[model samples]
Target: MTARWWQKGVIYQIYPRSFQDMDGDGIGDLKGIARRLDYLAELGIDAIWISPIYPSPMADFGYDVADYRGIDPRFGTLADFDALLAAAHARGMKLLLDFVPNHSSDQHPWFIESRASRTNPKRDWYIWRDAAPGGGPPNNWISDFGGSAWQWDEATGQYYYHAFLKEQPDLNWRNPDLRAAMMDVLRFWLDRGVDGFRIDVLWHMVKAADFPDNPPNPDYRPSMGEMHSLLQLHSTDQPEIHDIAAEMRRLADCYGDRVLIGEIYLPLDRLMHYYGREQAGVHLPFNFQLIEAPWNARGLAQMIAAYEAALPPGGWPNWVLGNHDRPRIAARLGEAQARVATMLLLTLRGTPTLYYGDELGIGHVEIAADRVQDPRELREPGLGLGRDPVRTPMPWDESPNAGFTTGTPWLPLNPDWPMRNVARQAGEPGSPLMLHRRLLALRRTHAALSIGDIRLIDTEGDMLAYERHADGERLLVALNLGHDPQRFVPPRWARGACLLLSTIDDPVAGDGEALMFRPDEGMILAPQDNS
Candidate 1:
């Protein structure tokens, strides 16, 4: 099958608020992103998935969007966004905007009008229902942020459903007018030359028609968050969601070459359905298994195998190591093992997404209780589920504030920023940044690594090995996920393979035809004949 640009390219995610601050306002903005376009281009990423920049009340940061088409003043004006788009395209890099379709900020005009009165013209635009007996919420559904999903509105004498914060009300997808209006929102951006959209909370767009109470999760634990207390049977991932996804896909298809990426967090079986019965659904249903899976070779191998096996025919696969919502790879796994994870992510038989600052091995920054900025953390304090640590500002240099801004940043920089900044690591040999650059360079030069077929060679102990082949070229990727040296014996076809890259700088040695991998090291080997 012929590959689309998105299918063969690597995607880098940039949290706009933390990427850079060109005007030194302390918060990164659109102009800031434009200023760093050259840096991203040099990083070898084909596309950048920027988080939401829409007008908002900052309730849930930018995710709680107040205006779908307007740019938030904090991020910059629409003119700034246009310039950034042009700059990215000029560098041959595609830009993807985050599209939040599930809900809108309570301050949104539509939501304000909808809640004005029961007889208002926009009353049906959002999900509203009469209170249950005893004047409580309509159902037992819980908000992902916390508490009941239904929020009581005194003026309307009814409760409006919100899957997240009460300040963000869920839209009624069942309303034909609402669906058309949302589609127009998609068109508004597509017409502006956005290459694609990373649809936010897509599966939550359409919930159960009956609003049934979700079943209790028998395996729930307090540490997993309150949302895990229920199976989410009625709140999300309803079967009808696929039809809605296809509708979004169709609209995106209207504007040729644009991709639709759904943010789904379902199991492999359910997640694959987002591809549609005939692969006509979202182009890429974001795969987040790696983020939740254990950081071990055997566990990752099994998860990868399951994901690979679950994909529909003609469906493309994608991999993600980290994102704005989760802890960084270096934080989840130690710094040494993060290198192995990077090798595994880039060498897999799918498109890979790199989170900003991950290339420099940036781990979670310590967020003191008084300094925490995430609403989730503020809402559910002491749960250790806040995402602010992973959202710290990017360290560009060793200068004050790591050169991210001239003013105080929204969040504190990692203390190691001086040594870990991009400027310091860019030219440093064996640095995490250099390793990422080399991996991306290798992927660009080798079709086998970019669009190849994968075969799991070994998944025993703390070692996981795989072979990637395409167009008569084969590359073996071996990762040692342990603290002790491990031996990897190549298959007969790779007997004379030459080491192309290694996490460690020293030459790889062999013991009786088997290559010895230093602890926590990963290497890529190409057959001598092909090399």
Candidate 2:
């Protein structure tokens, strides 16, 4: 099988509201992103995945879209978006927009009409059901944000379903008209030259026909969250979702060269189904194993093996370390381990998505109680579910507001921004940002690293090693997850290999037989002949 550009490319995610601000509105805008095209191009990424920029009510931070075809005025005008798209394309970069198909903002005209009366033309556009026998929600469904998933509508005397916030109503995928309208929404963006879409919550698009209550989770724990009390069998990952995914893929196929990336969080076996029986579903199901797996070598090795083993024939893999919703990698893992994590993510056999600000080693910022803006935190406080800490403004330089805005920023910048800003790191050799650039450059130059088949290397004790090979080129990647030095001998076929790259600035010295690796380090080795 041949490979597409997306299959061998690296994607960089940008949260528009925090990336940069050109209008001094305390929020990043499309024009700010446009002005940074050169910076992104120099970062060596092939594509930019911009978080949702559509008109929204700021309820779920743009996830609850009110208008599908228009850009949010806070971000910029439609004309500004067009310019950003053109600028990205001019730099040989692709642009991916976030698409929210599972729900729409309650303020949306479609939802407003749907909830206007029981007999409205769009009454069936959203999921609505009558009260149960006694008088509460229709079923035992729970919202991800918090509380019951059903919101009672006093005017219509019915309850509407919302998998997230009450202000965001779930769309009825069962309705033919609704599906057609949603497909039209995709067309609207594709018509404007959007390279592809990252479909949010793809597995939650459809529910069971009978709307049965979810079974209780046998291993549920209180600290996990309220939604974890149930298995979500009836509310999520229903078999019918595959058909919907395939339908979306078919529509994307019509545009030729456009990709459909589904954001799904499921076990390896179940996640494979999103690839469809004949590879007709989403182009990429978005493998998030790295984000949730244990931060040790053995844990990550097993996860990579399991995921690689679970892919359907002809299905490609993708990976992510952090996103706007999760804690920064530098925060979860220390700075040293985060560097090793970067090597692992890029060296693995898959498309890698880099979160904005991660290249500069940005960690979580402290958000005060009064300054908290995440709806998840507002809904469920004290659970440490707030995402504001990781969504702080990007630090471009050591200036007021970290050069993100002239006015106040929505979220506070990390106190270390003065030394960790991009400008500072860019000027320093062997900085985290420089490491990322070097790794990306290595991938760009080596087919074996970019589109190679990965084979796990058996080893013991605090180390995980793997080999990537393609077109007669081979490379070995080994990581040390321990805090002490460890020795590793290369396989017979890999003997006499020369070091290509190392996470640490020190040279990797070997005693003619085994190589010594410093703590929290990772290295890529290539054959002496190739070197």
Off by over 4 Å in 1: none
lDDT of 1: 0.90
Per-model clash counts, in order, read 0, 0
Clashing pairs in 1: none
What lDDT does candidate 1 reach at residue 279?
A: 37
Q: Residue 104's C-alpha lDDT in candidate 2?
A: 96
After best superposition, candidate 2 residue 357: deviation in angstroms? 1.1
Q: What lDDT tens digits, residue by residue, belong to model 1 across residues 1-531?
A: 477888889999999999999887899999889988988888899999999999999998899999999999989999999999998999999999999999999999999999999999899999999988787988999999878999888887999999999999999988999989999999999999999999999889888888888999999999889988998988898877777888888889999999888899887888989999943899999998878887778887888888899899988999999998899999988789999989989999888999999999998788988899898899888888899998999999988999899999999999899899999999798999999889999999998999888998864668888999888999999899898988878787788688999998888899757888899999999988973
TM-score of each: 0.98, 0.98
By TM-score, how accurate is candidate 2? 0.98
Residues 94-195, candidate 2: write the lDDT tens digits.
999999999999999999999989999899999989999999999998899878999999988999999999999999999999999999999999999999
